[model samples]
Target chain A: MQEQWTTTIRPVSGWLNINLAELWRYRDLIALFVRRDFVASYKQTILGPLWFLIQPLFSTVVFTVIFGNIAKIPTDGLPPMLFYMAGIVSWNYFSSCMTNTANTFVANAGIFGKVYFPRLTVPVSVIIINLATFAIQFVLFLCILFYFTLKGAPVHISPWILLTPLLLLQMGILGLGIGIMVSSLTTKYRDLTFLVGFGTQLWMYATPIVYPMSQIPEKWRWLFALNPMAAVVETFRYAFLGVGVISTDVLAFSFGMTLLIFCIGVILFSRTEKTFMDTV
Target chain B: MSDTVIKIENLSKEYRLGTINHGTLYRDLQSWSARIRGKEDPNSKIASAGFKVQIGSFMALDDISFEVKQGDVLGIVGRNGAGKSTLLKIISRVTMPTRGEVKIKGRVASLLEVGTGFHPELTGRENIYLNGAILGMTKKEIGRKFDEIVDFAEIENFIDTPVKRYSSGMYVRLAFAVAANLEPEILIIDEVLAVGDAQFQKKCLGKMEQVSTKQGRTVLFVSHNMAMITSLCTSAVLLDSGKLRVRGNTSDVVLSYYTQYSGSPASFDFRSSNKFIGDDHAMLISGSVVDSEGNVANEFDIRNPVTITMRYRVTRPDHYRFIPNFHFYAPDGTCAFISGPQEVTTESGEFEAVCTIPGNYLNDGTYFVGLALSSMETGVKAHFYEQNALSFNVKDPIDNVPTRNGYAGPIPGMIRPKLDWKIRGVA
Candidate 1:
């Protein structure tokens, strides 16, 4: 367990312990924060949860037109719409998790400042809630691929799809890490809000979202590979579309970065949660 | 039986009043300048020489030591900024101590504020579990006590509604229910009950009593209500300026606190002593309410001037910097009214702050007067008297008459002071 955090006293927050027992006692609260994330955003909206499916569908169409036709980028010989949709489904999950997790401290400071809980439960639940929505969008993407394959489009579903769970974890860990880091900093300097929105878009470009990894320059390929999301999306294309162009080395790099960022993010977040109220 | 379930020994907390952005050019400059001047840096306690008391670092809690026995309700009372909440926050694990240690044998739950850990979009039912889990309750425990919690909160019907749609009462009920259901070994409440209505307050009191006496749980309740502390707490701790005054039997501590209230003559003196004490351009002297015949009046007659007389020191002409101010606080601690000179008390000599209460203005009750004399130009206090604060009670002219608009029933606010009145009409 590596010292198992004998004491977690950050300079900002005093002595905020992981306190698993207290966290276990308040397990119901984790479920509540999850429910809040799931329902609160969609409340009074016209489409409600249906909006989850529409996001990837709309993006898939727009990307198919622009990147497939106008830009004429190779979708690794697969239909550009299906190719981008798969990546979008995965990207949507990470992006939402990142955004929601980043807002954790600012959004829930009222609760956090007044009560004690395993602060980890908040970002953890946010990861879970958005995963559920992303899960729905993923299903829709799969149904589309099935329909396109029936119409005689080249479609390949590999057993690497089984590796989806690991890829998902990699994405969650990375998102959680980055989200927690930004969330902690956002308390002191809220300037991150706009940067995250714009940076996420730029980050997608670096990760080969609308483009394939093969299009990246070989020497600079390592650069994109470092962005964990690029590895997830590349592995995803390899799993469903049989785009085996990705190197195993790139994924190993992604995994290493994921764990590293997640560890650093957790430490920073736990430290920030203690005194965020004083500054926030 | 252990005499103390919680032992807090020599707890000290030091806080830096200024920012510490170290490793910066400005910081190096400041530290270097401090080294040359032999003064401490404004941001840190360290003198350039090292660890000296700087003007910036303040010890919020200095060697605070106390012990709470099982089943004892201890009240920590203090004025604002007196380190009361900070101590409670430290004990509750919501904050940490800078120095010293506290040992607790059992679980501790704190209600420093209400609606904590509540999700606005979540339903009451969902939030109950969510808040319970956040408070360190297991799911099974929350499930088991779910029904009782709903019943206690009296929000069962709206349990499925999002708390955002709830009225404040419903919101507080759900929040308080979750907090109340936390069966920690020790409960810490920090003036949070001020959110509840009188009925809910009584209910919370009953719950706290049950938790302490019936369940043998130790409780530390921080409040300003001497009456509640006197009645509900078994022991009390009085905190003044971040230091302990007395901690012993509740009645004795409360009696000592109330002694500061029994004297009303100071109210008159504070009001009338302005002739010599305040800026002489406007000084108050020998001022007291008097009967029609100019005799010192023990109490105000409804028709009396409530006369306030003052002697002033007129050092020269056109010295209009003197202004008399009177601030009143009701028995319930709500600021009632602040009145002052409508016209300049020029031509210094002595001046007084006085306002005659029109008949029927006040509801019968005890009230306090906080007097201050300030410079009219800068509005800074030339002289303020809080130590000599005065307390007075209005006697019902007709003890049985029992009626005044906006004065009946138990209401909490400023201006509960009573006055004599009559309603007349042409028949």
Candidate 2:
């Protein structure tokens, strides 16, 4: 009699076989991992989750002092604190999600070596945890926005503010995409590990996190738009302070790039998850 | 016939040795460029000067194939580097095999290491949820069994404390408790019971026994403890150096495992060998198993006497008396008995010691002989001790004289000695 099997293990799976149903089955694991990350990071610290707010607040101050006063960089005629806060809040979310997910394979090698679960759950959980942190920082940004609007500091809240969720989703997908891709390579070539931190730092400077896109010449602004993060940061500023440029074509292009990178990342990640234990 | 729950077919796993694929971008680029140029890899050991590199790849599992029926506890026994863990990893989906396939019919929960993904910073209750989720249990499932798990681990008072503060024993107990509560259809355990105390191990064994026998869950176990394998597993497979060596009933496979590692050759000829097993005083010449008729043989009848003969050369003849003894071991590595004569040997150039085991005394199974020589004049000084130097098998025919009495089934014990018995109708 022919027998029916629930699981068949083979050498390699199809390239596009992402196993979405399995990922859905392990959604609880993802939630648990997110909780572990949140609780474990602040176990003995005095500040605990408050650090989420303090980090961006301190960075916004530094940027306001250095770029707003000393260097005299333009923020499209908006308040330096509000402008830097907007950019830092959004940029922090994307960068943290990317770096954390980039270390997924290496950080959890101990657990991964011992058991079997949907490997995608780790990176996905990282995005969720960073999203939680981003939510806290976003509230901080909203309080500063409310104060500036009350003070009548030339702020305009546009209808584009409704696109904030879409913006966060795009950043998450982009971060997960680039993160797992690098993680897959770092398994065999450990040199990529050192590059991730340095590369992300440089990547942040390339985006319009400090200076407004108006500071760049019109000819060179397209080059900045090539960075998917630039559109995210620029669109975020335009939605909140009514400063910086926003174009439907650039937004569409950036979203397309995010999806494309996400597909590639998933492909590389699935391929690496199978036999990475050997090389790792 | 029972349903086949797991079917493994010719699975093999190969791992790259030394540095995997150059380990760095520079070396990897060098190799890649050389490959494109039709030249040997520049980063390869062959291209380097004055360096000897081991083989590029090692096969951890080589063409192993087996099947497990429903509710069958299959024990996998082998020494270290015997492909047992590799096979388990492949089946657990923790690693991919280089070739072949494995089809499993139901949910498999593998305890390759207990408490995997358990964060020390998390409290016991929190870690239970985390570790259970990692082992493929949902949140609601863990919550339903949370009380039972805590009770089984016996850490009711410390359930709220972080596991990092718990003692090692308590930690293992808690970890095992969570795993024991897992209700997967197929359980793959790899030496996880080697931890914990004796009482905990017994509890774990009882739980496993209940899971397989009462609940009808299939189990695949890997362990070095032969006694546990014999008691817990109905059948077993033996692996040696990445190859399947033996597969059969647990008793027979365990016997093969012992004989395989014991290196028993049925006879030893030390006369022509330069590396002698002795000091300057005495050297062993030869040893063999012989039947009652005095002809050299490794098989003996249950009703006939078996003799073990050892020849040795005494270079320094003196008043120091030498004693030669033979230790007979049963199949399970337990010493059945020790036989030696009280007579002393002095002023001897060459000597032969013969110890005869009477008929109908030994059981029908393979037995190993360990030869030794020692002098007791000045002190207990061993001249030579060769463990498992020779082995032989004793056959028990169904029509055996008066011992059987028409019973053909196996009799359980280390020795099956026939004794005189008288029965009368007193009732």
Candidate 3:
């Protein structure tokens, strides 16, 4: 009788063959990877998971002192502390996801060289871990937001708050796209490793994180539209604090650019993973 | 006959020689643009200056094709850089082959290295699940075998401790236990048994044997240990210089592998050879088998003791406690026994270690002896291991012997030791 082979390995695979079923089958591994990252990062530390909350809080205080107090950046008539906290919390999720996922290939090269799992699982787990951190920081943001509203500060919860999940999805996909693209390039050219950190720091300025989009001259405001993260941060602030410039055209453009980059990133990532072990 | 489970066709993997990078991004971009413009690579000129012939790609595996059937314990034997690992890597999907295809049926869990994704800070129990998942086991599957895995590793008390805190032996045991519990339809193992203690190695071998026989799983095992490949494998293939040299029954392939490489000579004189075998600690001079009369010989009587002697020079004496050992192997490559001195020597200079095998101990067959110098001061550190260093034959005379009692038929076993027997007829 002729036997049926379940898997056939060939020299070349289709460029867009992402193997979603195989990724689903290995979902448990992705969960374990996330848990390992969460547990290992805080293993020897005294505070443990509290560091997740402490990190964003510390960064907010620094931003409040340096950018708000020192530079005298306007918070669009909102309290400087609440304004900077919202922007820091929103920007932290995207930046952390991008920076962490960018090191996926180099950091996990040890395990990747020996086993055959979906290489995408590693970056996906990175995003999930960052999402969990974002969840904690988001809770902290809400507690402070509740205090400001109870004191009857100038804050409004807009109907656009319903777009929070969509905004998060866009940030995740955008980070994942840029992250995997850089990771794939670094496998062959290590020069990219040095550039990722510097590039992300510059990118935060390009997005309207510390200053509102209104601060940019109207003609140069179009330049901000080119950055996919600009829309995510502005929309997040508009939904919670009720004071940031956003338009439907900009949101649609951001979503389109995110999809485009994500497609390119997944294609490049899938192709590189098959043969990266040889070069890595 | 069982159906074929794995079919590899003309599989080949090519790798570029020398450094993978072109030193700088400027040169890389120059080469990339040159290629796009249909011009000769400017960087190739610089590379060809020093590396002329070595600048080209090298073939790690060359047109290798083989088939593995269900329940067949196939052994892949070859020298280093002979494409054994390349073949396994292709089959395991860890890397893509440059040419050809591999069609495999059912799940294939390859233990290329144990504890591949194990976290150092994770407890033993958590690492078990993590490692199991890395090897393609689901969390549910790992949970089901959790107790059995801890039991197999024999570290139940340390299950809650982080793996980094466990002893090296304990770490290896736990790692191997998780891999051994994997129930893949096809298992590929690559010399992972070379770790752990001797008793654990035996247990792992037994477990692998049961995996192939009782579970009816196809297994592909690669190891430099001839005895392991000979006993554990039902069929074996010999690869030389990235090419298939021989494929047949285990003993025949192993015999050809030895003859093709080491030549199975009667004696070795490393003193005259320019190639060195030992480290700065000690070096082997020569090894030979001798008769009772003290003359060098390769043939011995079954009833007479045959002495195997090793001569070596120890450069550093008091620094290490050198333990010299010899491994005796039957013609089929199954290790007959390993003998070493009970006491170690700390004195330096020339030393001759002789071990005598009494008559009637070895069965009538050809035997090969492997020599090694090791130190147990810290851990088991082998200075050098030269396999098939010397070979000899034991012959039994047809004349009636008291133990034989007029029967001339051949006796079966690794040895033929004479034991006291009492004949009391109860009937």
Candidate 4:
């Protein structure tokens, strides 16, 4: 009987135990959660899934008007509409994923208290659902990209376009990592819950969403590149519009930082999952 | 000597009293440096008073150890704060234990709350799949069982409707159906049966009975309803103040629970209870049981006349004619009787209303008395109502009232009033 025991629960022993196999066993549950999140968001709305296109489309329009036309910000030789659309498409996915993933523990504390599943399934599904949303909006961006290309706008498409999926994956991983870390901290110090929303807004400015990284002075450009999301957005534009500079050194730096943040997030999240019910 | 499916050893859970893990890191830093410097911590000196208050944390479950055998329906009986839910949480791995370990064999599914993962906006069919997946069932498994679930829930017509539009009864039925069909090796259920109507509750109990007896699975049930425990469980454990008080056959354990606590005279006091909910139309000060001699008692012989008394202060007398009432509840939570004052106008003052029951009227059982003050003019507008305001035991051990017709078990009824019988033989 002792040898055949299926599971053992105790005070979390020595180092962290992240049973990726256990998470794999709950893969169906992750899919269901993804479906639920996707469906429940637009269940009774008049626009339904069209609201997905509306968000980034409207944000691009605003950025094009305010930064491109009014403020006269340079688009690095690409059409302002296509340039802002590219940035918005990638940045929106990352930011929304971060916000939703950061709220995983606090929002689902009720479900967590009553049921036992791999806690990682929740954040994983958050990434997946946001990815689904990004895919839909990516289609909308492509339509605009085709229109700009056919109109003979000065956009140079590059071979790096094949790396678009890889860029999105990096952003998703980075968001999940930072989000879970914040979620763990916010469980006890709920002050972070309020600060996350405010900080994400501030974080957007620090990233090159409204302005290009080259627009920043060369002395301060490296500091801007340190924001992992800057590399992701820059790579996205370089791949699609083929105008923004692609630095392997900076891209490597961002990828390494994302990997580090993800490791830290997993460690904190695993530690927090052991006793989050008590604090949450 | 049976196969033990669950073994809990020296189990204890310490819960921080006021705040949970707040400023914990800062305090740990302070205390850790103090320990290194060979000095007492500055914040460890203040002693919090009362039972639930602690300077930092207190034990919710303390040194409780028990074993549950396979296929045994185990009843976990306790007061509200006796750590029953905490015990189940640890066993189900919903929460981690603080001090001990629980070894569980095979798959365990716990319905700590009904509809735990149910989303209101999702259709009933979708929610069934969602809740099933949350309980560790694969989608293919849920699909295979979907027909049986819809049939058992009796909601074939509403299966496609979002549960938000469902009546509370329908929601609970579908939720319970999904849970009952999980077919795990071990099942842990809290007091979720109180949600549905009587017929649904009966169906749920029957399903549970079939699950344990026919399927040969283990079950751990927690409920305040002693009658249900006595009828459903084969064995039981009683918890008192986070400690194991008794463990044995269900009848003995429940009887011991009744005697150990309910039989005490001082345990039925409602003077300190703030259960009275009202808008200041009236307020209940105390409620208790009194013998024919007019002294408050917790234990009573069946042949002795007893009176249920409630003392209250009427703040607004002219608002409506007050009907101060007493509700007698059997051990199974059924309302045995509801008696109140006559329809008469009364003034603002302190008043004590007593309803006396004659000797040989009530059957032998543990009973709870509730106090209610209502306005008859507005058609039963309750001004102050407190459920389970007081409790007592009705015993018939002396053969004073010959109720058993050569039967060994207790007689069933709310009342056992004796009537004169005549017999004539035409030989």
Best by DockQ, which number?
2
Query: Docking quality tier of candidate 3?
Result: medium
Question: Per-residue lDDT tens digits of candidate 2, residues B325-361?
Answer: 9998875568888888989887768889999998988
Candidate 3 Cα lDDT to native: 0.86
Q: Which DockQ values do the candidates obtain, in the order shown?
A: 0.18, 0.70, 0.50, 0.39
| lDDT string, candidate 1, B50-122, tens digits | 6555548777777778888889999887667768877887776666677777777677777646566666777
Every model's TM-score: 0.73, 0.90, 0.82, 0.79
- Put the candidates in TM-score order, highest first: 2, 3, 4, 1
Among these predicted structures, which one has the highest TM-score?
A: 2
Clashes of each: 39, 0, 0, 0
Error of 1 at B148 (Å): 2.3
The runs of at least 3 residues in candidate 4 whose Cα sits more than 4 Å from the true structure, single-residue gaps closed, are A1-3, B20-54, B112-114, B265-329, B333-412, B415-427
| Candidate whose lDDT is highest | 2
Using lDDT as the yardstick, the better of models 1 and 4 is 4
Relative to the true structure, candidate 1 reaches a TM of: 0.73
Better of 2 and 3 by lDDT: 2
Q: Relative to the true structure, how large is the alpha-carbon lDDT of every model?
A: 0.71, 0.88, 0.86, 0.83
lDDT of 4 by residue, B281-394 (tens): 788777667888888776688888888877788888765887887888876779898887765456888888878888778887667777788887757788877776677777
Model 1 alpha-carbon miss at residue B168, Å: 2.0
* Poorest lDDT segment (10 consecutive residues) of candidate 2 chain A: A10-19
- Candidate 1 residues lying further than 4 Å off, grouped into runs, are A1-26, B1-3, B20-55, B112-114, B255-427
Candidates in descending DockQ order? 2, 3, 4, 1
